[model samples]
Target: MAQLLKRTHMCGVLRAENAGEKVVLNGWIAKQRDKGGIIFADLRDKTGIVQLTFDEGVPEDVFSLAQTLRGEYVIGAAGTVRERSAKNPDLPTGDIEILVEKLVIYSKAETPPIYIKDDDNVDDNLRLKYRYLDLRKLKMQRNLSFRHRIAKVTRDYFDQNGFTEVETPMLVRSTPEGARDYLVPSRVNRGQFYALPQSPQLFKQLLMVGGTDRYIQIVKCFRDEDLRADRQPEFTQIDMEMSFVDVDDVLAIQEGYLATLFREVMGVEIQLPLPRLTWDEAMERYGSDKPDTRFGFELKCLNQIPCVKDTEFMVFRNALDNGGDVRGICIDGGSKAFSRKDIDKLTEQTKAYGAKGVIWIRKEEDGYKSSVNKFFAPEQLAEITEVFDAQAGDLILIVADKPKVVFDSLGFLRRHIAGLLGLLDNKQFNLLWVVDFPMFEMDDEDGTMKAMHHPFTHPKEEDIPMLDTDPLSVKADAYDIVLNGVELGGGSIRIHDSELQAKMFDILGISKEESQKKFGFLLEAFRYGTPPHGGIAYGLDRMVMLLAGESSIREVMAFPKNQNAQCMVSDAPNAVDTAQLAELGIGLCDE
Candidate 1:
């Protein structure tokens, strides 16, 4: 049976003001120190730790019982608080120590496989295996607490704004729009399965049809796609929707939420309405859709350069004649940092992303030096350097290829170079909206046009007519919220008109029968008079990771799966009994 007495004070609450008061404390033993007749143990709870001393003055039995205590032993102590002679200013409860008059050992624990300290150097896989103990670490505790605070604040903010928190169905029909679905086989309905939602996109739109004006939910979404460092098989999204909202209205509410969140979470005051960057400007300036504007290595297009009129370097001239682009970036003070060998390494890195070769230019005290200089005279190098305002210590890196390859390869190199130079400011967050995204992109493998976002994303009203004539020039009403070059979330106004939706399907090569087969229910719902609505879904796990200042979501999660989406703690997604599968009329096919 457990002790009848409940805890009167927390481990961190017995300060100098409560020095002479009697208090009952309950916690796990953090550390035990023995000093002849006196034994001191640091008792720790979720709040913090406090020192508990069992002395020879009052109870000899208590002092002897304290000697048996070890790390992580759960105990209940009734003690009188006293000021310590030598106060340890490092701890919050350092000024006062608890003098125990009673001690009750609630539970005895075996030595933990991993240390409970914050700085324990255990392997990550081992940590995941012993995740319960890993979560006992102070960092994980703080992370969970911070996440709760943010969630509470978010809910309150949306609620106050007349947004009704609503839930959508998780088990629905599968539609191949984005990531692969996680399907669940049903025993009651044999040969049928329900797919977990990648997002509540269609349901939320149906909510608009049902006249649920504003809907919000901190919902869990699942996808059966391959995971990356920043992705998970299942994750939470701050899903929201609203009726009669334009792009500006959505941005305004989000901006207000950001201002409050940054102020409360990080204690940083953010200015209202973060900057906006167009797709064309963002790609041309930073060679990325989500540009990191924290530093200043902007991509420079050399279409204006006049030195390649009769150059022997066909790479440069051919790119211009073939309707491709020549772009470069000036790395500040890289003339000395990158040796010839280092430049060769950089060239190899870009080649992975499909660049044929890299052009290197070093501005020296003598004259302009370049890898392609043997093919061009000093005068040509001077003309190229002058275009980029190259100083004596600057290094210019150029890529001459198709516009797509040039942007992709050089953009990757720019980020790599920035990391090598430690140009990212960890303390600074550059948030911006990358607006006016292209409606469709040509799939290289299939040579077919695919939606940049989802197919349901509505094209700009002005571009609606262009769908029939010039589909490539159309822009969607999509907006991506990017934080320091990482895309945090993206959304767009959805197609509400059945006529326009049919037209969109035609453009995407979705036949009438195919569209009806996949999205007939959604089209049927749209016929019930849907309102003009749009919403955004932010990755809640990633957002909390950013707020907690952690590198990955695993740190913020209590029991997270590894990169392969395997649960080390519970050993989930394991093989079940063959009889159970047979009962469901399912057979395992050999790969």
Candidate 2:
């Protein structure tokens, strides 16, 4: 615990220019080797790794101490920087080596379960269980450092743009925000509970009413939901809200932020005024709201084709008879790529997305080979390829189902097939603004109309009339920022009028009393002249993950929960003591 020598230089920064300089470095011993009575080891700090040399020139005790070094041993080495006899072209500090004069052991470490190397190929659970050691890897350290830089850039960009940083409550009243809330039972108010904020959705809007013109917060939000690569139970959001701003104003400010963030952090320039696609157009063309425009598997409707519409084939005929449509996507050169067994496997996977089956046609060199050639004439098969301009070496995949299912099937198929073909490139950035989302969508199970976004999103001015007659046909003043195929974030022009707010609640099947019971504070605040405010919240984890070209947000997070929402390192979500539960007037239920 005694201080021997203070760190004079980082391990990675000792360059050839700094030869003859006496420096002290504190770090873990990454590797150790003894060749011809000279001890050489790689010393690592957060900055980087450098070679440390201990020869017969050092004192007997110092050389004896250097011999004990091993991987992950915490130590301090005071030495003179000199030119390396053998240079490692792979390292930044490769041209120089530290010749040790004194040494001190801070702590000895056991052999780590997980290797402190980037390409170890260790098991996921083992890496998580020993995350502290895993983080020592250069890749993880770089990922965390990159994340820190992103946070700093986010704060700097918003602050320079006249936005006030505001902190909101962690524990607040819970309204239905689509996702389930993680509730904390109150001990003081027996049997009462405080729900974690799904977002600062209501509070941010209330800030607008309180006359805060521009607000920003890199805030934490919670959602008790299913976990995936991108979804975490607890996550951070680069949340912002603005008062007296329309869609254009909010979007312009956001684009400016993106320009600044990408240019500074990634050294990439994002072109101004990003491309846009309406919700309808996105679904019709790509069959997805968050359309990945990097590839060309665009969906084409087969219902209007004369041969397909009039075909006696049950797959097409039955779907058309029941108000459904037939649609397909053409894959260039896919005829040679997909075998019948491969197509069958893909067909099975589409069933999980509610597709009945897949109908395929391969345009060969000689003629067209079709799955439904028995039903359709040769001319009809030729017309199928004509619909997609599909030439020889092209494969057309068709899905016949209800419009929604049909679109959903093709949406997933395009992306899945693209992945199989290695067509999605992370280096290629495709930023798009998806706007004019539907105000309401019919719930498949209940057959009731639910708000496509939340209820507070302002309805399109012209579509307000349809709230009484056809609310599902109405659109909202909402926009989502999408990258590749992922929806990075979304915002809407909030309903500022109380009457309109009430109409939204009513249309979503919430009664007058029920609305007051849930969102009374927000409803009451809106009565006193709320502004035409709009806001967006970006998933900070997702942003950093994408920036780092990582498949999972877990790679960027310091301590992330596993697939079942349990922390492997800390063994979180464990049972609490009975007294603690009793104090909160709660009892355990059988699992």
Candidate 3:
């Protein structure tokens, strides 16, 4: 029988200082080699890996037991620490190895479905199903450790900054608006449902009212929305709310947090008060509100080009006449890069996003070459090319449609095309505050205007008067932090006055009674003298993914659900028993 032992040192903790001292180590066997007379085993734990060697001369029984060890078999070794005969320069514990005089095989493990190594070849579903084993891999373990460090640093920073970490409710009354809610039927209160929070928006505001002053919670929020590579049904948000704060105050506090966070998490000091770009400026330059500013392929407006009216290109003329837009970006040395087939496929993708088509102008060795150039004579082509400052080997891709479609298509294309050309440098950290978003956006279906951020976001003071007139022209105090074309988080100074809140609801097409029904308590609280409040919530998982240099948020998560929102490991979202369903007075309608 194997002897029980107490561990004096971790497998990865031995060094030259303890060379003459005896120690005990415990870990799983990462690898084992048998050369008949002598056996060697590399033991691995979460900390790192260490090697153990057993020779017949040291102990015949220990050598005999070491020979029985296999990969992933749990074991304990008690021996005198010694210098390694063959030093492994690559390993952390390379200079030292344990010379085993005592060996204990604790438990044996079967072959794992997935290899406990980085770059293991296993299907994602299978890996998730055996996430415990998958997490045992060095890469996954490192990701988790990095995530924990970031989280700890963030919490500590906030705590130092006079913010209180509070826990909010997971089950609350369903007050639906933004995304579909995940409802849980309450057995105690029949037919009534409790919805998982899409966010702690309302509760955070209430906390401000309750005088929490500065509140932060690393909380789990749920949204029943379509999943993407970066999205999961249940995800964590580093939520925060502050009372008696204006836009500047909120930004200042956040900038301090970010400076500390970046220094702690990435070892890179981010300069405080990062650059800010107005929503219009960002969209006009990169065709995206969340523009990746690491590379330059800025959008150039051709709406003022004189030939646009007389070009005879119907797409261009119709768009110009219909109060739409014509914009394009000059790709550096792209003339020879994209062929006709490639441009056609780009046009197809733009069309899917509602753009009519894409037009291209190439500056060749001689002159301008374009499919639409037939409509423009030499003089006109020359004038248009001159406006764009065309150069040899340069390609100009243009889109003409409604302003929205034009921006959306070219914006997505700029990033996509830049990625294809390897123009974006991921090593650079680019942070921009996109502010001055329009207060309301027109719904294409009914032309009804709705708040761009949310109804509670306070409109800019000057634009507040325009709420009764051109609401669409009004801008809000909202700002989003964009990093590499991803909106990391967003928040706004809220409308705390009850009258303003009611006015916002009116503009959003929610009636007085309707507002009361959905947000009656909040409206009532606002009447009791609420302070100026604002807050932001960051996608903590995505933030950790960036810190870990990971491609997907799933890599940073321990046991994330798949794209379909089902947990392969836990088998969550599974069907309940028929008797339980009957108790809830519900049954599937389908046959």
Candidate 1 regions with alpha-carbon error over 4 angstroms? 12-18, 87-90, 308-310
- Candidates sorted by lDDT, descending order? 2, 1, 3
> lDDT value for candidate 1?
0.88
- How badly does each model clash, as a count of residue pairs? 0, 0, 0
Give the Cα lDDT of each candidate. 0.88, 0.91, 0.87
Best by lDDT: 2
Instruction: Give lDDT tens digits, candidate 1, residues 1-591.
Output: 767458898887677999899999998999999988788999988778999998887577777789999999999999899999989999999999999999889999999999998889899889999999898777888899898888998898899889999989988999985789999888999888999999998898889889999999999999888876678888999999888888888888888888888888789888767999989889999999978888887898887677764554789889888888899999889999889899899999888888999999999889988888788788888888887788998999999989999999888888889889999776898899999999999999999998999888889999998999999999989898988888888788888888999988899999999999998899999888988888898998898887677888888878888877899999988999999998888999989
lDDT of 3 by residue, 99-202 (tens): 88888898998987778878777888898899988887878888999989878988998999899999999998788657899999888887888999999999
What TM-score does model 2 achieve against the real structure?
0.98
Worst 10 residues of 3 by lDDT: 378-387
lDDT of 2: 0.91
For candidate 1, the 10 contiguous residues with the lowest summed lDDT are: 303-312
